[model samples]
Target: MRNGLSTFWDGRGFDLLLVGIPLAFLIAISGSALVYNVVMSFQEVGMFTLGSFVRPFAGLKNYAEVLSDPQTWPILGNTAIFVVGSLSGQFIVGFALALFFGLKFPGSTYLRGLFLVSWVMPGLVTGALWSWLLAGDFGVVNFFLRSLGIINENIFWRSDPAFALWSVVIANIWFGTSFNMILLSVGLASIPEDLYEAASLDGANVFQRFFTITLPMMRSTIGALLSLGLIFTLQQFDLFAALTDGGPNNASNVAQYWAWQLSFREYDFARGATVSVMMIIVVIAAALFYVRSTRHEVRG
Candidate 1:
């Protein structure tokens, strides 16, 4: 018995144990929860049936109902706008910041570190801060616009239907831009200085080097960043909850917050689960793309 135990500890059993524990935990916890959610999406889940795994089979009725809702497409459109606007603003600002810091001037490292305050702050806190910043009457944003003569009167960013969605988008961009900048900075640092020197010697201009060398070399990094950004933006809920609450006539409503409202607020569990299932499909596609991009990078 002693020898057998010793062999197990010293041999393949150790490796199996290391791998199996996490696998078992994942299957028992995350996997089970995911499976339960998916199953609930196809079942008639309600307050009474919520505790039980077995319920009346709904087939696709829940999905059909969710899709048939009048506000569904508009909410989805808002989500699309939020996601695209946030990602574009975050990426452009982040990449530009990354390039600026790459110059390695005085206090550049410290300045870059300061930008990480946004990344470390809790989402709710960030949302609250931005909410104050975007207030109509006494907000700094409106003050700046007024000072610049951009508008005649204060714009209600959170309450106005026209700007409610964009208010959250701006907050999201600020919240996430730091993360994007950090990742992009890492990618930029991994690039060889020799390449830039060679390109300069060959008479390549700044834009030429960026387009030819920087972009191609950073393809995998960009792909991974965008995929991760998609998942994160889809999951974003705190900003919406704090800043708008999908309010002012559901103007800023998004899929994630809408799913929550359907589930907990309205007590419509099955339809909420259906919406979640749809989002899960999108996240899965993004994950697959991230994996493929990293694999291609490894091969190259």
Candidate 2:
């Protein structure tokens, strides 16, 4: 009996080592990249005849400059609005669509295929298509509005400060909703049918079952998806770049967009790194909260 248990333990130890080796390498690589970025945030450069090279030991000056800048809070506020608007709109819309599709339908398979096309398309193409449709002049959307006599004048969706942020937000919503739909649909499918049947027997209506049963059961899954979504949305830059270019007086500028402008547009790499590091810290904090909450649920 002792010899059999020892043999099983030896095999388990070998399997653990096999799994741990690749995971350790991945961690090492990821850690090195983060350290490199943090170092670069404190990096400085000076021009010389040959070329520019980083000056060692700039310390906290880069971070201090970012903190003292007047644009920081405004940019942060815009980022907050963008993240919240996108997440809320996407979650509500996506969950609704997922629920609708989850119901028995004749052409549900075809509908799901169509939904997947949007998710599979390139982000640049999606942004470009939205930009064209939302253009103030000679755009299909403006023409339709005019045809309906909704407005005497064409609305400047991209240029006007009031509409610029929302214009970008709308495009982001279209792009991100598919992701939520897929995730929530999977969660909805995972739910046991017997629970729903018991609820139905108790005379629970659609809304009641959703609120009391579906939501509570799916909370952990929803939390996990939202946590990842927040990280991705907070780091959003591509749609902004392709659609608005953070244009019309920086009204639509997000943290990621601002960081890009600082680095490549303004040629201020150090400040850009500082901004990125700040974003990383914020995302990490949110992720930590998600983990803690999820763990508590598991324990309880």
- Top TM-score: which candidate number? 1
Writing each residue's lDDT as its tens digit, candidate 2 over 1-300 gives 997677558897678778989989987998787776687788773223114443666889999999899888878888999999999988999999999999959998688768766667777888889889999998788999999999889989988988888888888888889889988998899899999999999999999999989999888879987887898788777788887888777888888899888887777777887899999998998798679647866797
lDDT of 1 by residue, 1-300 (tens): 988788687887788888999999999999988998899999999888888877999999998998999999999999899999999999999999999999999999999999999989999999999999999989999999999999989999999999999999999999999999999999999999999999999999999999999999999999999999999999999999999999889999999999999999988899999999999999999999999989966786
lDDT of each: 0.95, 0.84
TM-score of 1: 0.94
lDDT of 2 at 115: 78
Model 2 misses residue 283 by how many Å? 1.9
Candidate 1 segments exceeding 4 Å error: 1-16
Distance from true location, Cα of 274 in model 2, Å: 0.5
Worst 10-residue lDDT window, candidate 2? 45-54
TM-score of each: 0.94, 0.87
RMSD to true structure for each model, in Å? 2.4, 3.5
Q: How accurate is candidate 2 locally (lDDT)?
A: 0.84
